[model samples]
Target: MESMLFASIKPMLATVGDEPFDDEDFLFEPKWDGARMLLHKQGERIEAYTRSGRRVTDKFPELKEAALAIIAEQAVLDCEGVCMNGGRAVFDDFAYRLRLGDSRRIAAAARSHPASWIAFDVLATTREHLREPLHDRKRIVNECIEPSERLSPCAFLMGRGKALYDWTKEHRLEGIVAKRRYSGYQAGVVSADWIKVKHPVEIDAIILGYRMLPVFAFVIGLHFRTVRFKPVGLVEAGISAEQRAAFLGIVAGGLHAKQEGTTQWLKPALCCRIEYRDRSDWHELSGTTFKGFLPDKRVDDCMWTY
Candidate 1:
């Protein structure tokens, strides 16, 4: 029983062009549209856990039902917990589901907006630990189960780097992840086995003030400052906790007057490389983080234009 517990680890990401390996040499998996879930079953009792170590079994009744119906013996599999509404992912549709504590609501939502387990990697089966080679474990999971209305394997494509990148863009998918064909699973943080090839999206923007979230510490903003930082956009995707701390320390007391409406203005001392999908004439825009500045990228580089 102890040997069957192979922990699944998160993948590490590489910058757009840093240490890029040949795509043909790596396995490419689709970036799923869901939350990371770990499934562990022992006898008649089954448990579903979130990546953050929280038990979410009650929140997803459909998954619970499917787990009981299909799984055999003791096994651990890494998958994405996806909620399907009208045959497509609504992205943030599961927000209410997580917070919902009522079992009746859970059942109703399970029937209305069902959840699917998109299996990506299998860590263990019975007493055998398949973590040593990803290719072997993937084959075990791929051949063991048949696709159903609620379960499917993650999509994969094999090609050169440029071809895969082009395919991601054509499908409007997030990006392709590159993983070594043979690498063991290592738990906690990002592991060395994986590298991501994502569309390079960047923009030069001035840092406005910061809005502090309770748990997230601080969130930065980007909008034209001449009329004051009137809530044009936010930065959430790329900036790390270390960068957030450093940025907050740099602009600690540079808050200007609340402009245009109720938004606050911050001193323009930072310029960051932001990635987004929308590129339009300025009035308002939506984007997330991609990468950030080097210590050498000076504040003089940030200037806004209409």
Candidate 2:
């Protein structure tokens, strides 16, 4: 049979929320930390596309097998391509597999760190199901796909978002995504129909430098009374345009030291709040984002946790 090709549909995105709540109309699922992909399958032919429309079929042969295993004449699925390490999804492992261009290395990595497709939504089966309600489409996904080591339905809990979020946090999972039961899939839109609640580790850090190339980012450091200030990580997200302009002025005024390249060193006098998912093995903060400047927080008060 000739391979079938489907349009690359942009994956729907979720809006960020403060906390989780119990709602009869909502269903909660674990927000996996992995690449969002849409899988298209026809007979033995399979293809995968990322959120930005990048074709990644060659990178993950395991997921292709999983997609082909689905019992459908034609199907499209919304999923996360996850590589697990110690029972938790690891983005680094997934990225390692994604970046492999050579078939031999890709096969080797597949044997060592195989990826799985965690299906959460169904967009088509013989025909498009994009206009169907989420609850109905979810049923189609469960009915059409056979769960295996490389393919599994994303587990969900209804009307108990807070409890699910707490369980995710307790297990050190990334976060929880709550979606309206009756909401239809809106391609490329970051809709309020789905909201994400994260369990992030908060910290106070001192500003070490600033980078203004490509995008504005702050190089932050953890302060110790004995060791003074030590570099932790860089934060770029959550900084507003107004905040960026104001920070540029402040950095220019405090230019007492210099560093090579685009980084302009600043005196460890400014403090800010940062939130991150966790710390890497090198003690660097992972998924760091600026929360806000702490005008009342002194640099001496900045300390490292874990």
Candidate 3:
């Protein structure tokens, strides 16, 4: 493993689990609603990359002080890049920051809508090849990284997943993650050692198509096995007028569009994050609501669960 090139490595992923449990082997924490990022700090230079390996360091300059937050010669930290609004993480604010290109605009936006890095695990400085257990690695994070307004440590409870899950659910927070105490970090790997349970429901799905006639709603679906998309149902609520226009312009490029009756079919190119009450069936999504566009996710990332 190349120690310094950790920016190229993908962040480890969590698999969806059925229910939360109180187990001594697992440490549970609130699952953040934002993009996954891996922060690399070597000497005076710090770099931030999305789970897909896209460099987003310049996009949120307010976090530039993050380079000095880590009190170490070299380190690679797994963090969640989040924007807060009214005490809750807001994906729309974070997405808006990620889409900017101009430095002046980005700098100005950073002040108006700032993002923070919440460190959960330390990989490189804890050990080479991530051989250390999660408990020890997290200890390194708590000690090495000094907390600031922009960078802070993630909080967790030992053997109390069910309690945290209930609280998050009651408050309508994102959800909770259960990580094995002795598990080692696995870059780019989605393992059972780490489990994610959402509050009610929220998952990534592909925009199979859309219909504009009676009302504007997205025909959303998820990837099932080898199938590209398994159409679930239409997501009608929570999409702002600005969001509607923005998504329409991008999919209308003629590069990923097809017409089937009144519905405009689209190639499996656009992905969105949505929250629904539940899956009434294999094809129906109850109380489906659009969260926002997840640029960090691919079509394959929207895997079906049934």
Best by lDDT: 2
Q: What's model 1's overall lDDT?
A: 0.59
TM-score of each: 0.63, 0.74, 0.69
Give residue 298's lDDT in candidate 2 (0 to 100).
Answer: 87
- lDDT for 180 (candidate 2): 98
Residue pairs that clash (backbone atoms under 3 angstroms), model 3 = none
User: Clashes in each model (backbone N, CA, C under 3 Å)?
Assistant: 0, 0, 0
User: Candidate 2, TM-score vs. the true structure?
Assistant: 0.74
lDDT of 3 by residue, 1-306 (tens): 254454477878898876889999999989877778889877787888888898988897866687778887778889998888777776656767888999999989888988998999977864463778999988998887889878889999999999999988776667899999999988889999999877667788988899997889999988665566889889889999999999989886873667888888887788898987544313367668999998778787788643
- The order by descending lDDT is 2, 3, 1
Off by over 4 Å in 2: 1-5, 202-207, 210-218, 221-255, 259-273, 277-306
The prediction achieving the highest TM-score against the true structure is: 2
Ten consecutive residues with minimal summed lDDT in candidate 1? 11-20
- Using TM-score as the yardstick, the better of models 2 and 3 is 2
> In model 1, where do residues sit more than 4 Å from their true spots?
3-21, 68-71, 85-88, 128-130, 159-161, 200-255, 258-306
- Report the C-alpha lDDT of model 2 over 82-146, residue by residue, as the tens digit: 99888888876776677799999999999999999899998878777778999999899999888
